[model samples]
Target: MKFDQKSSDKLFSKAKELIPGGIFGHYKYAVRNEGPKFFSKAKDAYFWDVDGNKFIDLICGWGPMILGYNNPVIDKAAQEQYSLGNTVSVASPVMIELAETLVDTVEIAEWALFGKNGGDSTQLAVMISRQETGKDKVLKIDGGYHGANGWMQREGSPGTIDSDSSEVISIPWNNIEEFDSAISTFENEIACFISSPFHHPTSEDNVLPKKGYWEHIQKVCNEKNIIIIVDDVRTGFRIDLAGSNKAFNFSPDLVCLGKAIANGYPISALVGKNYLKEAANKVYFSGTQFFNSAPMAAAIATINELKNIDATSLMNHHGNDLKNKMISMAKSFDVDLRVTGVPSMPYFRIENDDKELHFKWVDNCLAKGIYMTSYHNHFLSAVHRESEIDLIVSLASKAFEEIIEV
Candidate 1:
């Protein structure tokens, strides 16, 4: 069942001379010597490697391929806008269209701003919070990732200095006591409390907030005037299209979105209430590509298409089916497979405290064409069919069998 990775390995070898680490950032870390390194083509819920090995993409381009790869609707939107001219001297009217669409769709969105990546949205959210509150410190959850912003990154990560995260206070997820402790200690110094709607750290079981957790935090932050910022970059569309915060029944001042927003188009959005509109305009955050028309057009089309398909509910159904089937299959093999987070974005873990065995199982799955990761959570797209769920469970059972045999 192992797929050949010769073509991928050779291409990576050539890339190493021209590109640092053949790939850089988080992507370089996902490299498996025996796994496909580069893809030649991708379609609905699946992809083909350069060597022509096919796989059911559980990672879903790490989250952006929510509708699926090569979705004709999304592609046509981007292509048509490109044909009209992608980047021009002025901002495109499509930007307005995209903003209007987000405002209409997102529950708390009274205004929307564009960025090229999730990091951009997160950084912009932080900046806007700081600008409005005039507070310099940020409060965040431990192990919560909001992109490569130095303040948000783990302290002392290579080029980042100690001061980059000096004003940041990290708290445990779902721990109300510590959250209060932080608020008491920081007092008026904290500008915003930014975190994903749920706790989804790498290499660990995902944790949801305890009951009344958001309600308590919301009340406290309101009293203290600390802006509530939901870094929904990773869990945006998959959880609830109105915004992840809505699912938890808590309101946030600002919501950061990306990954699945445009169905693989390069766009991220920062949506907020009208009260912050002035501060948002005051804080400057822009890039040359931020004004690109194609992504905006694609975003508009993607949002409309998601509504047309009820994509959130569809993905939830697909992910839940796959998770339940796999967990049941694992039990038959006497494996303790735990799936956490939301129904649409499931974080799978082998709960035996044996990391190597877990990795081996994931490697086995990868070799058998179920492209999943050992460390991070996997994304399920609306396009993942019922047949694919059965296939995934079957492949995962084989992986469990292999581990058992070993």
Candidate 2:
């Protein structure tokens, strides 16, 4: 049966009249022409659209719902904090507790700072980098998404002056020679080198670092006295409890974490070495909601649960199972399918001469009560059990069959 989205369509019409572009940024409803625009509610591993069409969510709210939507433990923690008072004139003790938890949990994190979103942490990291090193240039990987802030935004766009990114340098990922050249070109002026642990560029097949790639980068950054910043906003706890830097076996000077940190709560953290504390104090990083204790309480609960349950390992196992099944099913149908990136965050690339084949396959999956996206990596939640994985594989087999029949 086809999924109904009549209510979603009506909402979209109203939204387009009221809000510019009908929705904001990455979650834009227009990205998938066949996807629903409004969801009535979401629970563990699933959500219902406005028309009451149920779907097994593979996107995981774009990477924040690591444990699952409306997780009871996390919500209860947040609710308890809310009852105590979410905001106060002075920062709550939960902030200190969460910081302490991160320092103890994340490798190389001796200090932590809170923010409301990924962009907040990233932008603050940039400021801290410059202030601490007294340098003007910052290096980044080409096509890497740090955030939507001025300096971190794409090189050229409206509303951002040339000076905003004038000191930033970009080089291709996984190429040590190019990285060396960029560093040499910028020399002593460079302050920090920031990048995601893996190459998960939008709409492209995700790329893993080659053997020794991260170790080499770390060596060079250390030799050059450049601070290394790992933007683990999308891959933090999902990769490992200690952060993706630990998963990749590389140490970073600073790490930006968000999304899954609080299990869908609006919170982010910039964890760094102790040396940067002075610079962090000098930088003006403040938000009214940044001190809200609810998300901090949720983060504490999430981190405790993650440690007890080994959630990362479970997610990776399930994700790998799904990847293997999808690949086998595609082979059975004689279709070319490639799965890339870490198991926890897998991107499926369809090799076909037909340009629309990917979209058609995703539409087929959506019709079959599965919510998958063609343009981004799929996330696996801890709640996706073996049975759900089996069901997803079966649905994917049908999606592959539909693609072949077309």
Candidate 3:
């Protein structure tokens, strides 16, 4: 099942001459030597590499291809908008339409602002919180990623100064005591408490929020006057249409959304409650391409399509089925397989903390055209229905068989 990488290798060689890292995106951190370097095309729940090898795309372009690749509905919307106007000198009405759609969908979203990436929305949300609270510090769960902003990154990441994270406090996830301690230490200095709805850090078993975790945090933040910002960028439309906070049964003042918002279009959103609307209006954040209208059109269509199909429940059905099938197949082979996070976005791991064995298993799966990763969680989409799951799990079983034979 080894894919021919001659085409991929040639591209990498050329890319290295022009690109500093040759492969700088998140994929570089996850791909294997045998993995696909460049994709020729992608369809529903699958993509083809340059060598004409096709693989079931469980990663879904790192959580953007929620409906499918080159989907007619989304593509038609973007194309229609492109013909009308793309990056004009002014904003488009489609932006308002998309915002209205989000306001109608997300529970806490009364108003919405647009951006180009998850980082843009997150950075803007933090600024708005700071502006509203007149505070200088931010509190977040340790290991919770909010894109590539310097303050959102760890303290000593490359090209970031120690002062980059000077006012940022990192506390443990699912630990109310840690949150309380940070709040106590920071007191009135903290502006916002931001984190994903759950703990889905790469390379670790995804941990759900313990009982009453969000409730306690919400209560404390309410009492302390700290703004609650839920970074729902990755888990946006997958968990619940009204927002991931609805699934967790908590309320956030600001919600950051991206990734699958436009079904693979380059757009992000920061939606918030009425109280933060004035602060958001006062804050200044803009990008050269932020006013692009095509992605906004795509986002409107994507949201409508998700609602029409009840995509969240569809994906959950398929993801839960895949989880069950894989676990059952692994049992037959005496392999330990653990799947975590939401049913629609599952992280797979081999038990006993065996990193080497887990990587080997993932490699085997990738070679056989069932795209999987050992570190990050994989996304399921509305199109990944029963047929796709059958193929994915069947190939995964073969991967297990090969590993056992070896």
In model 1, which residue pairs have backbone atoms overlapping below 3 Å?
A: none
lDDT of 3 by residue, 271-359 (tens): 99999999999999999999999999999999999999999999999999999999998888888899999999999998856678788
Whose lDDT is higher: candidate 2's or candidate 3's?
3
Identify the candidate with maximal lDDT: 3
Candidate 1: count the clashes: 0
Q: Each candidate's TM vs. the true structure? A: 0.98, 0.97, 0.98
- Which model, 1 or 2, shows the larger TM-score? 1
Model 2, stretches more than 4 Å misplaced? none
lDDT (Cα, tens digit) per residue for candidate 2, span 242-336: 98988778999999999999999989999999988899999998987888899999999999988888899999999999889888888888878
**Model 1 bad stretches (over 4 Å):** none
Instruction: Kindly state the number of residue pairs that clash in model 2.
Output: 0
